[model samples]
Target: MGAFTRYATAGALVLASLPVAASARAASATAAPAVTGAARADVTVPEAWGTLIAAGRAGKRGIAFGDCPESEMLPESLRCGTFSVPVDYAHPFGPRIELAVSRRAATGDAAERQGALVYDPGGPGAASITFPLVGEWSAWRKTARAYDLVGYAPRGVAPSPALSCRRPEEAAGTPTDAPQQPSYAYKRERIVLARAYTDGCVRAAGPALRHYSSLDGARDLDVLRAALGEPRLTFMGTDQGAYVGALYATLFPSHVRRMVFDSPLDPDARRVGYRAGLARSRALESRFGDFLSWVARHDDVYGLGTTADAVRGHYDRLRAEVSRNPAGGTVGTAQLQAAFLNAAFYDDYWAMRASALAAYAQGDPEPLVTQASPRPYTAKGDENADAVRTAVECNDGVWPADWRVWDRDHTRAARQAPFAAWAGAWANLPCASWPRPRQDPLDVRTGRGALPPVLVLAAERDGVTPYAGAVELRRRLYGAVLVTERDAGSHGIGGADNACVNTHLETYLLTGRVPARDAECAPHREPNALALNRAVPRGTGPQHILRGDPAPAGS
Candidate 1:
């Protein structure tokens, strides 16, 4: 069958299966995480929360909405505003910082409307305010019509109180890519550079650096929830935001209503040092295997190879050649891996990634060269984006101070998942010397009654936040139902037109019911591009460029 026909068939199957969604939920609930543990006779909010709620109740000031600075670029209906939140929650009346917030009122009937559905697209550094403007709106719009869609720029991110790192001119010349089989000299240089980066962030942000952790972001969410006048918080946190939401639920369980965590981070991994590294390494390796299969299937078109092993060998040879000699002194082995690794996360770009690789191998280096060049940092608030990405991760939990910890972990991980192991290590190296007190990773446990019925989504072959993390998160949050998109390749799974996943999401949002047990969404074959001579669709709008930031690769 043709690719279009295949996709249509998948759509039909997805639709035909929806009539059983209610029964499916019942069937799935049987397999869901045990929710019988956290049910205490006296479930209570902390003293801090009670105080904040009291303060909010007394103040009587509603959220102040104004013309969004980006309104000209956005649809007129989405309003934007800012509110002062304490730099430190403990010192509520002390130093204050502004938070950027945007809201799109519900389009559904006002009588049936739920409260605001706050969203965090998870970069820890990614501006949440941008989600309503640019993210996959249709996926949630069905339920969003009755509820306000709200997004925010967390502290130390763009347009809020953004943080900065005083990067030196010489620092700009340092190679950001992971050096393959580095010599002792190279290792020493890397250590020095990592120290410099950390120092620069400390110098630029000062004490503010300590206030940018995920825990702090969660607190900020409470403040936002109060400002919006919602009695309880309804949220959707993806990627790192999953950790943020998890922390919020742990810190203020009674305040949660409906929550959705997609492609979640393992709360356990976040607290310790380098544990997430292993998870990321394995995820990348699994994705690499998927890429190999794709290339093998299209050997007739690309002439790379007709077997998975042969395709992998061809790739290994190409990468090795590039490591020895970068093409046009731009696309090095690391650069090539970085560029195409995007394919492992989202199948939408596989055709382009493959075409670029095939072209590079045939001696035209422009495709790979252009794909690998770093984004120009001239965009507004780009430096702050870097600062927040580093600060939050560094302060969130203790990263081992000793270089040997990374050395041991990266060396072991590289042996198995070479594509991203060392590269990820170098990407997150700044945490080693971060000039802030390291908070111990939170032991985020969810007992039976600890939280509301949450929905967790995961793609089996996720490249950044691994599927294992999602499973672990589901188990920790007792009663949470996990929706797995089997063999789906995207880092974020909700963007596609998958009825199985969307039905669960909309149902849970509209009625607070989930599939009773864990469930799976059948994978749909990605639509293939036409021949090389056909005009390829250009990627438009704002794309997420989070290279060398906190994440493994993608969000």
Candidate 2:
């Protein structure tokens, strides 16, 4: 249905799985002691947002990130441009990385200019270029529009050098159960191929791959700020991007203006080793359980089962059979399991899940194949899945160089989750054998300057950022608030249009008044069994059926 899985990949391992993901921390630097979970219990809210200690104005110019959607175009006042940054900040002159950057200036009378508002749309790989152009309605957009709204693609990501594999063969191995597809003989073959593919990137990535670290990625944001000629930067980051914000705010505290990170990632988790990855898998399953339960109740939509337990057993058996004998030569346990990866993100995607299940029950290979293809089906499909994901995810933290740990955890996850365990492992395993030596991730605690504190948002049930991880970021950051959306699910934060979270986000984004105390949002109800929005006569309104962003003020 699309090129690459949704950034909202379900933890294809672990079971309710004990919440394997939320509490992850980045690996720390040499001697900085790490903070304990307890320290995060206290949350801080800042004063006013974008309260100008100073001012700067901009000319009527649109910064280009890429061509705007053919549908959207503004003359000079708002444009797009690319900023050339040091691939490795330490080596400013050697190799340059260009960030696809964009900006939309304040409405009128430029003299009372505030500052620049930059955004990161999660996904160590999601696109942020369109953010500013579309930011007018964001809860924070009014304040942001008070200045310039800036956007940039991370290194190795789209519009940015775009790490890609060129072809599926580059991804290697046919789809089949890990055991049956690989056999012991195939395992040896895969090992060789994996090493070769990773090796190719080492030679090809040039110096850019080494610098894609969040810390370096943060530097890229700093470069964006410098190019804007702003004294400081006001940033808005969601999900994985929160990690980017933390690293930047910490690294360039004096350069920081006001920052807002929704769906925070643990800085320590980003800097840590394999153990955190495995733990997050379990946390992810808890989020998935909510999905499974919803699926069971809707037995009519998907005949998967009538009860949650039965639905689990059914999916487990279905995938296990494919492991032993792929339905066709094409679909295997990994591919089948990977098909459901988006379940961890939005409840709206349950439509995709129902489709996948129905296709499996019919034993059709099309749905599975579509899900498995890392790129797309054009004359020249996408290759970035392999390169971009690996370049950023792998270097961000050190995966245990040992296969033994991966194997042990993979086995444990298979037993516990049965559905997603091994599949996710294979989807991301190339990193284990990557050719380049790993860079130690930065704990990113640079609370040494005058950056205004930030507001961090997270849902308690989010499998990705996890409530615990948001707490962690608050602890490590100099002056950041951890405002919990107590009962939501998936990777929601700034990404949500939910009024519950949106109000808090809006208040903080509008002015830097975070809830004086840590707050809890109402839990999200699962996907609509019936439509929830205002009635549109059949397809009469907003022709597209997919749900709009959940954040009300923004969406």
**Highest lDDT against the true fold, candidate:** 1
Off by over 4 Å in 2: 1-78, 105-113, 136-147, 165-190, 269-273, 320-331, 355-375, 378-382, 435-437, 446-450, 530-555
lDDT of each candidate versus the true structure: 0.67, 0.56
lDDT of 1 by residue, 1-555 (tens): 000000011112221234433333342233212112332211122224222532353225557777778523656778888765666544444456677888888888978889898888776677767555432356666766767878788887766756667542332322244555666787788889789888877666566567778877876787777678776788988888888988777766767888888888878845334677567777888887887788778887777788878877777777777777776675666556666677776666677667766776688766665555444332234455667777887787667789998898788888888777777787678988887556677677777676779999888878878888888888888788999999776776654457788788789888899998999999767648433422133323222321212222211
Minimal lDDT window, size 10, model 2: 45-54
Q: Candidate 2, 242: how far from true, in Å?
A: 1.3
lDDT accuracy of residue 357 in candidate 2: 58
92-185 per-residue lDDT for model 2 (tens digits): 3334555566677666356645777788765666556556545445444455546666766677765555666445453344564554223456
Task: State the TM-score for model 2.
Answer: 0.75
**lDDT, candidate 2, at 167:** 53
Judge candidate 1 at residue 203 and give its lDDT: 67
